[model samples]
Target: MPRIALIGGNARPITTAHELGVDVVLVHEEGRYEPDFADYCSRILHAPIGDSAAILEVLRPLHAEQPFDAVLSATEYAAIAAGEVADALGVPGTTARTARALKDKAETRRLLDEHDLSPIRHAMVASEQETADFAESVGGRIVVKPADGVASLHVHVVESREDAATAFKQLREAGYTRAIAEEYLEGPVVSVDTFSHRGRHVVFGMSEYQMNDRFVEWEVSTPSRVAAPHRAELTELVGRLLDVVGLTDGPAHSEFVLTPTGPKVLESHDRFAGSGAPELVRRACGVDLYRMFLAVQLGFEELPQTSPVNDHGAAIRFFTPQPGTLKEITGLDTVDALVLTVPPGEAKGNIVPLLSRTREAEVVVVITRHPGDTLPELRSVKDCSSGYVIATGKDADEATAICERVVDQICFHVE
Candidate 1:
């Protein structure tokens, strides 16, 4: 039997790995790891709490004993660490340089600027005055975020000096020492997932991104219903970006904005697509991205055969109900794909509001076989459809209309 060792196994990708029939050897502590499905392997390894050197030390003995056939890093930090270990262990993986470029927002933007890919007007600010000045110099309105953070933590859209000050203060309170402010691009956002092996990159699928506020991503749907012209343009642009970035192996997930000027790259991840993206893509397309990555790590010369498995699109929407004691949920039976981040009866701390807050109460996802299914059909029937809905359409107008319907559904309830 082939054995695969996975670091950062505390994430969504671990579930994907389990779904793909790969035995998972979790590196994190037993209590911290959670899987939605049954695991084939009951093995557990304690992970280093803070230091990378400590993690390496813990893994050194495991590598000698189990002698894994492949190793996968689930998180950005782990990916960077895994790169070095892969080289030492002669296991195939991403380079530390590539992982760094993708993980650090400041470095990512700088590299993109240097490549003349998308000229992002941005600055690294450590103080309120510097943030205000940077925003003013970049024309006042800007998007501010942490250089190395995930889940849209401490992200803000500053419209003026005052807004920048508030955003800076919030970042400081959140323990962020530095943040990057860039000219906010006004347009719809989309995410693309790809797989690269032996210098060849294959585009798996593209999905539309729905944001709750400035930083929280609420939904992702595959086969984004985008205008034909824009879709063609984006496809071409993404292909070129993969070449430019030299993404030669493993998986890549990139986000871009479809602006009037054209498609601009927002960010990219040099790992398996996050969230339930791998599963969503697999449902839409026959590709099992996790298994493909596993094959890549094992040095398989030929890639797996992947094509659209279903004619219809699939989408997922995350929700955060009014942050309070979990009373009850009323709409799970009505939805096709639903995952509650916080179970019922859980006290959700004061979540940020949609306009200013970055988190939600829960997440609801919908999958449909019909291309014409509107967002209204996907909306939760409870509370008169007041909660947020994220839908994926076969093509752009469908996606846009679905998003509009989701926005409309969210307005049914007002605090």
Candidate 2:
């Protein structure tokens, strides 16, 4: 059996690893690890997943007892630790340098600029005036965001020096000293989700996003219509990107903006696409990325020489309910799907588990916030965690319509 060490993710990968007949050890922080995961793994190890030394300290002894075939992670930050652990233990996985280059937007920007891959004007800034200077140089709209931030938090779009200064002040107050200011990108955003083996890249699904002003994706669909004409270019670009970053295995979710000029990279990750995107790929391309994450690592599955064809269209939509204390949520029973509801103000660890389990249900309704919970204003993905709907259709449009129709049937009564 291929013994694998999985760091800091939900239960999907754990369950999949078990099904692969691999002996898996799950590493996560205390209280955060799912209780149900015990059934799938032989041991559940706890660690501060983001800390490389801490993870190494825990896994080193276990690795010495019996060497691991691979080290992995499904989370964003923990992937770096996984890489570092893999290197330290002399296991096969992404290198720390590659993971860092991919995770840090500033590093990615600099690397891409050096290679002249996906060109976008960007600068790392330390002061408000420096940010304003970049904005002034752009002479139009610009986006200021944390160099290593996730979930669209603290990302500010500004066209004026005053707005830039205001955004810088907010970021500084938020304890983000390392920020990047870049010229704003326009056009539809899409992800060219790929799986690679030994540096061979295969495009699995080109999922497109529909976003709110905050840049949080309200909905995403597979087999990108907007990026249809640019599939070849995108595939090549992602291949170049993964090659540049030294990502030789697992999934790559490379997001891009289809500008009038051409496709420009928004960002990319060294793990599965977030927010139920792997599910979107399965529904559309008939490819299971979660399965591939384990299967490819152990060399049980061969890398498809060609990109998997999308047989159908699929989409996922999130619930951005009114921002207030919840009074009542009604109309859920009308939808023919698995509807999970918690107290309005209760804890919601909703997204990851629901994304993988909403199988066979044409529509899935997940409500993370229950009655009396305060729905803070949707400033970032963090605030818009009330719930979401994932659906499928004959095409992206159809799948999106299915999600929309389901959302319509469910009503949130927030005060």
Candidate 3:
């Protein structure tokens, strides 16, 4: 079996790696390993995935002894470091320079500006004053987010200089030293998932999302509803991104907004789109992106074209509820479309939890309240979730309808 070096401790990739019959030597931080991951891995090297020096120190000796066939990572925290390691080991993967630029939003914007890949105007700000100035310059309406944000955390739309300054302070307090403020663009956002090999990008799939009141992605429908002409346009744009970012291999989840002017990239991640997206891809197209990532790293000279597996639409919906302590949760096991569900007890319980910038609380005083373990209040996407529900149907509308039935049945009695 070919030995592979996988950076990070995400269990999904580990389980898939095992299925591929590859010996996985996981390089991860201390205490980052999932309990079940050990069963699939051949060896575990505990070190911070971000520490290139430490990772190299461990992998250098191992490579000299047995030699790893490939080095790769599926997690954002480990992608850059994984690339650096691959470069040091003389393996094929994304270059360390490319990985670094793609990981930081500010850096990505700068490169896009330099390359004329996007028309979106943006600036990086480290202080409230800088944020206020940028917002003013952008007609007093802008989107502010952490320079290195992931999973859409701390992404906010500020309509005024005051809001921008406030957002800036909140981000700084949250440990984000630098942030990006860009002219707010109004449009529908679609994701283009692709696989790149030797500077060639192949479109894998596209997904569109439905955001909750708080702007958290509550539902994602795959095989996006984008028309054929626009789909081709988006594909070409993603190809340009791949070239500019220097991602020669592996998967990319590139998001773009369909602005009236044209389609422009919001941001792109050099990894598989999370939230059960790989499963959606498998159902829509006969492509296993997880397997592809591994195969490429393991030195597959050419990847075969995948035919459509089924003519259907797939959707994943996350549970969002009103904030309060949980009195009881029902219909946990009843949903047929349920793909992942974490118990209420296992999830967090909170009353009047701090909402994200986009979400607002509707005050209603209740006469009676049920007493039970506290349920986590819904705030951002990172907040404790009841888990996700996945459904497949003949079309996007049908898939969403199935998801609605599951969502309606799952109830949380919050006080």
Candidate 4:
């Protein structure tokens, strides 16, 4: 069996690697991996996934004894480090130089601006004064986020210098020493879930989102109707991004805004789109991207000759309850969805995706709350979710409708 090293992702890919009869080693942060992941991994190692030196320390010895065929990462935060490991091991995957550049949003923005690919006004700010200066230069609202932020953490929209300083301070406290400040692009943002294999790029489709004031995506639907008109534009831009970024394999999602001028790229990722994007891809297009990630690395699958088309639709609607003590929750009889158990604030068990299937439609409900746990407010993508409902239908509208109807039935009573 071909041995593969998967760095810093959920258990889905580990399980996929195991089922494919590959000897998989999982490298993750201490106390961060799911318990059930050990069952799938041939060897489970612990290291800060962001620290390339530490990860190489653990993997280098093992690799000398038995070589690893490739290194893979589906998580956004660890993609660069995973690439570094692959390069250090002389493995086939994302290169170290490419991953480092992609991880830095400011660097990618500079590349885009230099190439005149998708120009969005941006600057790299290291201090509050720099942030404020950039914000003032825009003369309008600007978005300030961690230079390597993931899961929408510490993203601040500031219109004033004071606001920019405050945002910078918050990021500083969060241990992010530097940040990217950008002129706020005013348009409906959509995700282009594109994949590449050996320099070839293809977009599976686009997805739309419903975001809160805090930028928490409450609802997500694939094959966006609003973005369909600019398919040619998005496809062309992604092709350019792949070329400029040197993304070699796996999934890389680039977000673009349908601005008044046209489509301008907001940002990009060298990994699979999160928020159950692989599930959405599987439902809409007959492609399991997560499985594809593992299979291609393990040499069990080949890159497709043509891109998969999105025929149907799939949607996920999160349950965002009030931030208070939970009193009670009602309305379980309406939807026959799976109930996943977890502690109120945090979960330490297997993040199993719960699904109830039938021929016509399928419903997957992942509930992270119970009767006594306090619910947190919508913040970053990490701790905000109380639960979520995922469904698939004939079209994007129908899939979104199924999610909304199911979400309406579940009620959370918070004190």
Strongest candidate by TM-score: 2
RMSD, every candidate, angstroms: 8.0, 1.6, 6.9, 2.5
Instruction: Output the lDDT of residue 140, model 3.
Output: 54
TM-score of each: 0.76, 0.96, 0.87, 0.93
List clashing residue pairs in candidate 4.
none
Q: Taking the tens digit of each residue's C-alpha lDDT, what string does model 4 give over 1-415?
A: 8888888878777777777888888899867765677888889899998888889999999899999998888877688888888988898878877887788888888788788888878888899889888877888899999888877889999888788778988999999888888899899989988778778887886999999887877888998999989988888888898799778787898888899999988888888787777788789988877777877655578878776877889988888888898888788656776545454444542223332121234776677777778777678776555777888889899999988888888898999
Q: What lDDT tens digits, residue by residue, belong to model 2 across residues 35-137?
A: 6778999888888999989999988899989999988888886978888998999988878888899889999988898899998889998888898889888
What lDDT score belongs to each candidate, Candidate 1 first?
Answer: 0.60, 0.84, 0.72, 0.80
Clashes of 4: 0
TM-score computed on alpha carbons, candidate 2 = 0.96
Candidate 3's C-alpha runs over 4 A off are 30-33, 227-229, 305-310, 337-374
**lDDT ranking, best first:** 2, 4, 3, 1
> Candidate 4, which ten residues in sequence have the lowest lDDT sum?
350-359
Alpha carbon deviation, residue 255, candidate 1 (Å): 0.4
lDDT of 1 by residue, 231-291 (tens): 6666666666666666678788888888888888888888755545665576466576766
Off by over 4 Å in 1: 10-24, 35-38, 48-50, 243-246, 299-301, 304-310, 331-415
What lDDT is reached at residue 29 by model 1? Answer: 45
| Residue 136 lDDT, candidate 4, scale 0-100 | 79
* Candidate 4 TM-score, true structure as reference: 0.93
Report the number of the highest-lDDT candidate.
2
